[model samples]
Target chain A: MAHLLEVKNLRTYFHTEAGLVKAVDGVSFHLDEREIIGVVGESGCGKSVSQLSMLQLIPTPPGEIVSGEVLFEEANLLDYRQNSPQLRAIRGGKIGFIFQEPMTSLNPVLTVTRQITEVLELHLKMEKHAAQSRALELLKLVGIPDAARRMNDYPHQFSGGMRQRVMIAMALSCNPKVLIADEPTTAVDVTIQAQLLEVMKEMVERFRSSLVIVTHNLGLVARYVQRIYVMYAGRVVESGTVKEIFGDRRHPYTIGLLKSVPRLDQTKSERLVPIEGLPPNQMNMPPNCAFLPRCPYRIARCEREAWPILRPAGGKHFVACHVDVDVKERARETARS
Target chain B: MQYYYWLGGICRGNLGRSLVYKEDVSALIGKRLPVTVHLGLVSLFISVSLGITAGIVSAVTRGSFLDQLITLLANVGVAIPTFWLGIMGIYFFGLKLGWLPIWGYTSPFQNFWLSTRQLVMPAVCLAVVPLAMMTRQSRSSMLEVIRQDYIRTARSKGLKERAVIMRHALKNALILIITLIGLQVASLFSGSVLVETVFNIPGVGRLLVNAVFSKDFVVVQACVLVVAALVAVVNLATDIAYGWLDPRMRQG
Candidate 1:
């Protein structure tokens, strides 16, 4: 069966004064219906840009989707012009986007009701009264207490978590087929993160809409997502079923990310092991392997070969690297020493 | 005391008689108020509309040819004195082209076309600085607002580009625009003094100027009082509008 959404060889560039920035370079991924996936990366890894490109939402002139095919529901979204009627209808109507900064994402002068009802009115062709009633219901679904009264209030009246809940409500207002939450919990307090994630999962399941959580936090993705794609230097270096990725992770970048995250399962006090090298600059990226400078297990051939494509290392697990480090041999050598 | 005597007359709704016009100060003001008000309103309408449109265009199509043109015009607008522009306007539009009257006022009620023709040069002169200031103020303000996160959110909702600009960006940018407009009202009337004299129009500014020259204390004080009152009313309206536009301002 065909996938619900598939991205083929996406490349988004920013023509800055300094030079061109290949923000999302030759990245490809897929999402099945009702599935939850996470796109993990550090800042500037192009996780957010890739999703924005899918909707053609990036600011033009400075940002340009150089080349890409965004296949959704058997239609190539990129084939539609940025301001075309079809793309406009599909964006907020069929697919909802939840941005990172909920605090500022909402129009401050407008009431929460207006923000939510606007989407419904534009896409669903609902009357003002009808859209408002639906907005109240969506607010309650997203776990906003006193949804009725808060609907009339401005964004500033609410706390950070409450505002985020409103954002979730707005995104799921139309019962979208796919919901993209771009770092939805980063701005909130840590205690609210778990609660917010749970509420998000429940809402996604309730709407029967597939969720794509774009975040840099590995731990958040590990707990919430069914599959995870580790992006490095604007490329998906590793992807697999959650278990395969965390258990038999082949990419050095992925391993570095996992180690950097402070896990709760630690019994003894251990220092956090952060990845040593700085991320590669987009303007001056090395032609061969972008990760060559940072890869601890890089072989002599890694510098000579061009960046490798995703090759199956195991069932449902793929790794993009020229050489594979022997896991058993490393463990044996460590033990003997 | 002169103060108490003058205050007592005001309490009785009597502004005393105009020594020069030899009419009740109230009656003199009533006759002349309409012309001044008409000029003010028309000039304000032209300035605000052109200024805001230019600003929105400048901000939206930033660094474009049209934006550059507006910026250049706005810069020139601030530099040219209203009196100098009026003289130049009279030379070109009045004396040279005979397109409009160089001086005097006609009630629109009497002859609409003649009144419009008579009002053009003076109105344009009065509107210049405000239009210039308004353009600069709103351009920067709109530039800031359109870059805001909420504007992005509005676009993400798939609004047509124009709808996003008008509905989302415009309202947010309006508060600063309103404040600038309020500040401009004082300048508008103050500048009108020069414009009315240059055009020889029978406006309140001309009445007050003539009174000051002839040493008519009663008319001078009343004109100042009326202008101050108008400014006060405009400021009050702006504050109320500010509170209404932003709910955050309304709360304690």
Candidate 2:
């Protein structure tokens, strides 16, 4: 099947005062039609940067796409002149983005209707009356009550969840083919987060758009995404079907992540297994495997040489570590017990 | 409070007569008011238009050669004493160049071109302070507004760069610019004294300066009260404009 989006050997680097920080170092992934892909990593692991690079949203001068191709519908987006008017037509019209902070994402002073109608007017060339009606429709579709009255209200008037719904409404107003949601639920409460996730899932399914959900919450994306890409130190350490990742995790980092989450099934006496040591600084990343220093199952070969390439273990399950997959599992189970 | 009430009554045209001029203070103001208004309004128009345009350009192309040059010029304009700048203008544009009349105002009914020519030098000189002040204020305000998240949102919406700056950024910066307009009015009324004296323009500034020197208490008092009233009114207008510029102010 032809992929809807494909990123090949993506490398986004930031030239900082200390050194060149490899924000998204040599990452690659693909999505098919109606596929929901989850990119999971801790903060600063380049999950956000990788998605930003796809949209060419990284601020240039300090940050740049060093070398890569972000292929959307068989076309390399990275090669397009970002400032060109033609490229902008594709941004909101073909692809939509949902930022982490809903408050900061929506323009504060503008009415929700104006914000939504901007996309309709710009890309669809809809008239004011038509665009406004469409905007109200989108607001209703996102489950905002009294959508007509609320259209003229500012972002601050909405609750956190409502504002997030407004964001979702704005994102889906153009019926984009791809929606890139970066930490959409991190700011809201758990209930609101769940509601937002449900709304997003419903919207994605209804629109039949491929969704790329980037978040550090392993549990949040487990049910939402079909394929999961686990990243560490700006690299995709492991990527496979959600079942392969959660059911039979291979990468030591992936296993460590699973052990770290406090499961609801756990007893009151159970202690969460937090990953030891901080993530490696991208500027000072080790020459060999980045996770080797933090890995409990680190071998002599892990320190002496570069880590093994991402290879399929079975049925499209890919892992990066050279250590035996069974050994990593045993270590996780022992730590949990 | 009684004195303020008295002042308010005088402002409402209750004041009787000017001791020095031996004329009704209300009548004196009515006659002289139009001259001052013409000078103030024209100079304000020139200053605000030129200053805001220059400021926007300077801010949008920050750190560019034009920005640096405009900043340098504004600094010099602010530092130069208005009196000295007026005298220098008179020397070059009036006496030396012989392009304009050295002093006086002509009735526009008599000769419209010549009357405008006589008014030009002093008006230009009186405008300098406001121009300098407005340029600095507008540049700083535009800089702050440009950094706002709405500006980025506007850009991301696929609006052209000019639309982002003008509609998004500049509109938000207007409250500060309007506040500066009030300040400029106060400074311009005071600063015009030197220019009016040098040019012999029949305006309130010249009247107030001559009255002070002559110790014409009634005329001086009348002038002071009028200026104070002007400042108060301008400030009130500016306060009202705050609501128009920012909706948050209206809520408060």
Candidate 3:
């Protein structure tokens, strides 16, 4: 399948009074057509920053995309400066973004229909009547019950989940080729998270659009995303198919994340093991491995040299670590024995 | 029923008699109310339209030279007293420039053009302080609304920058702007006092000031009641507007 989007060496930095903070440092990835991918990281891990950098959506005054190339539809999006007509055309019309916090993400003063139709009118040039009907159809598509009647309702009139559904409708309204959902279910309850994810998966399939889910919850995306990118300290520490990641996890960070999550299949009362220490500060990062302090499998070379670059471990699986995977596995077996 | 009887004269539409004018207090207030309303409405219109426009411009172009200029002007406007500004207005437009009448009131009904000419200086003089206030209030309110997640949502929708601002940011900011306007209504009435006195307009403010000086307790009391009642009505209207603009406010 042809690649819908390719992000190469994206580095987004914030110039603050203290110093330059490398929010997204040397990140690179690509989304195949109609593929669903998950980017897992703790809060402030630069997941959102990397995604925002793709559309050039990061605020520019203090925040700048110092260097990066985002090729969408064979065009470098980063080349188009902020608010340029070309960038604006692609931002919502071709590449839609679903932000977190449905409560504050939908305009408080506008009716749902008007908010949805504004996108249609701007990009599609649909008339008021046509846009209204399309917006109603979109609401229905997102499973908003009685969508036609709710068209005239303001955002404040809808419940939190329903408002998020409305946000989904607006995003998919334009049939974007790539939909980036930045922690789409973070603000909702557990029950609603499953339902929303289901709706989202269904919507992306229906629209034939690629999905990029940015979230820290490993469990939530395990079943939905086909490929996974585990981020640590603004870098992709591991990348592989779901089966390879969960079954043959190579990176220590990925293993720690999997262990931290409580499993339903485990009937025994076992305590979840959380990763120790805090994420490295973006401003004063050391030349050595960022996760070295917390990594149980850290080798002497990890502290002496720069963090290892991503290298192929096995069939389409990659890991960034100085320790050999086979050696680490043997050590694990010996320790268990 | 007991409270009604305690204020029986007021209940019966008798506001007592004016001491100096030797007329019914209600009748005297009735004649003066129109003058105050006319001046108040015109000044309010000028101040609100210009103030809101200035505020929106300042907010949208924040960090620009124009925003700094407008903000500095607003700060200076709030600091300068209206009475002092009125005196300066008369000295400049009325004396130095010889552009308008210095001191007089003309009934628009008798001659519309002359009335408009007579009103320009006083109305602007009356509007300055509130205009400055509205600009500051709306600027801050608009700044807050612009930071909301929804405004970012609006931009992400690929809507034109203008539509994003006027439709998304401005509408949300209007709630606070409306409240500011409501508060200004009362301030305008009081502000008209000095302006009316300076321009020699026979509005309620002037009547109240004259009655105060002459110890005409009935006339003074009537003017105060009228101003108080107008302020109450303005406040009620403002609340209704809030409910209309944001339905969440409607439930309560």
Best by TM-score: 3
**Which candidate tops lDDT?**
1
Model 1 Cα lDDT, one tens digit per residue, B1-252: 998998899889899888888889988888888888898888899899999999999999999999999999999999999999999999999999999889999999899999999998899899999999899988999999988988888888888889889988898899889998888888888898899999999989999999999999899999998889899999999999999888779887
Fnat for each model: 0.65, 0.17, 0.70
Residue B37 lDDT in candidate 1:
85
Which CAPRI tier for candidate 2? acceptable
| Regions more than 4 Å wrong, model 2 | A16-19, A279-295, A300-303, A306-309, A322-326, B1-12, B15-19, B98-120
1 against 3, candidate with superior DockQ: 3
Q: What TM-score does candidate 2 reach?
A: 0.88
For residues A118-167, write the lDDT of model 3, one tens digit per residue: 89999999999999999999999999999878899988888888988998
Candidate that scores best on DockQ? 3
Model 1 CAPRI quality: medium
The list of candidate 3 runs beyond 4 A from truth reads B1-6
Q: Candidate 2 or 3, higher TM-score? A: 3
User: Global lDDT for candidate 3?
Assistant: 0.89
| lDDT, candidate 2, at B150 | 56
Q: All predictions: root-mean-square deviation over Cα?
A: 2.9, 3.3, 2.1
Worst 10 residues of 2 chain B by lDDT: B149-158
